[model samples]
Target: MRRDLASNIADVPAIAPAVQSAAADGAAIDTKGFSSLAFLVNTGAIVGSGDFGVKLQESDSSGSGFTDVAADQVDTTAPATLTATSSYKLGYRGNKRFVRLALAKTGGTSIALGAIAVLGHPDHAPVA
Candidate 1:
């Protein structure tokens, strides 16, 4: 995890619940969190299970909200195999501090996410 003092100071008291969702082939996930900061997505798969891909999006509005941030197509051809983890850092250069983070499965028949972690501080410390 990296650090940015300016953004960290702005993220304090602004950290909200991180969200997650999955799709069979074209499903979508949605949730809210602090804006203009970076976030990481930790994902993996189970033994004998199928592989999956993820698509990330964020929004400043509540209703009809969300804009595409990053999208990844994961190949889970071999279960029980150690697949490389997927990660993304979101950065926005606007004043809007409130935004929603959404994840959607763009590919694969079945997929699962271990956890969605948000790091960095709205002050000076990093999220642990």
Candidate 2:
């Protein structure tokens, strides 16, 4: 197997153990030292019927504010019956110093989600 290096530009203290149950903005993640972000989602439990969405967001003032990046949103394929082994991935290009994942759950009885955000560092420094 091929090996690759990973970086956490968001600087989160730890990976989010549980995803938001309702529609809400998540904690800000610092992306100062990286150029890209990858969001990995693992659903451990899901019940009832409802759709779920995860979107990429950005902030310019650290964690004080954030705005959704509509083009980078990801949605669950099976809203009615989410499988425990289901996984999803979203990618974002480096644009701001801070970034985050926004969660939106609708009409679901119960669901448990785990997410880990990873940042990718450029192989070479920017030339200007």
Candidate 3:
């Protein structure tokens, strides 16, 4: 009888599929998931000459609405140049969820944009 009971239990199907379906229906995957999200400012509409600075705001405006994750200083000299390359790694805790890149200019002059790329595991893995 015990042997038969053990075999029956082993044959039982798991309910994992139901749980996974629930997770998919409720929670939305962010960059922490297999895919990542990013934005670029090339038109120079956000920043221009004599601009104090530029703030990269998260498009999602909710509880933690757009926060100033990063900023860049503009160099105000002849042939104004971007003081530094503005790049920021955004994530919660120790995990790097997303990467943001922007340019800062002192004067109204267009600058060549730096190539931005994203790389990571094909599967959803926590940023180490």
| Candidate that scores best on TM-score | 2
Computed on alpha carbons, the lDDT of every model, listed in order, comes to 0.36, 0.60, 0.27
Backbone clashes, candidate 2:
0
**TM-score of every prediction relative to native:** 0.41, 0.70, 0.28
Please give the distance, in angstroms, between residue 38's alpha carbon in candidate 2 and its true position after superposition.
1.1
Q: Estimate candidate 2's alpha-carbon lDDT, on a 0 to 1 scale.
A: 0.60
lDDT of 2 by residue, 12-128 (tens): 421365644666665676766666667776676666654566677877876576877656343333333345658776676647777777767666765677677766664443311
Which candidate, 2 or 3, would have the higher lDDT against the true structure?
2
In model 3, where do residues sit more than 4 Å from their true spots?
1-30, 34-65, 70-99, 124-128
Model 1 bad stretches (over 4 Å): 1-21, 24-36, 46-51, 70-95, 115-128
Residue 7 in model 3: shift from native, Å?
A: 42
Task: Indicate the residue-level lDDT of 125 in model 2.
Answer: 39
Judging by lDDT against the true structure, name the best candidate.
2
Ranking of predictions according to TM-score = 2, 1, 3
Preferred candidate (lDDT higher): 1 or 3: 1
In candidate 3, position 127 carries an lDDT of 35
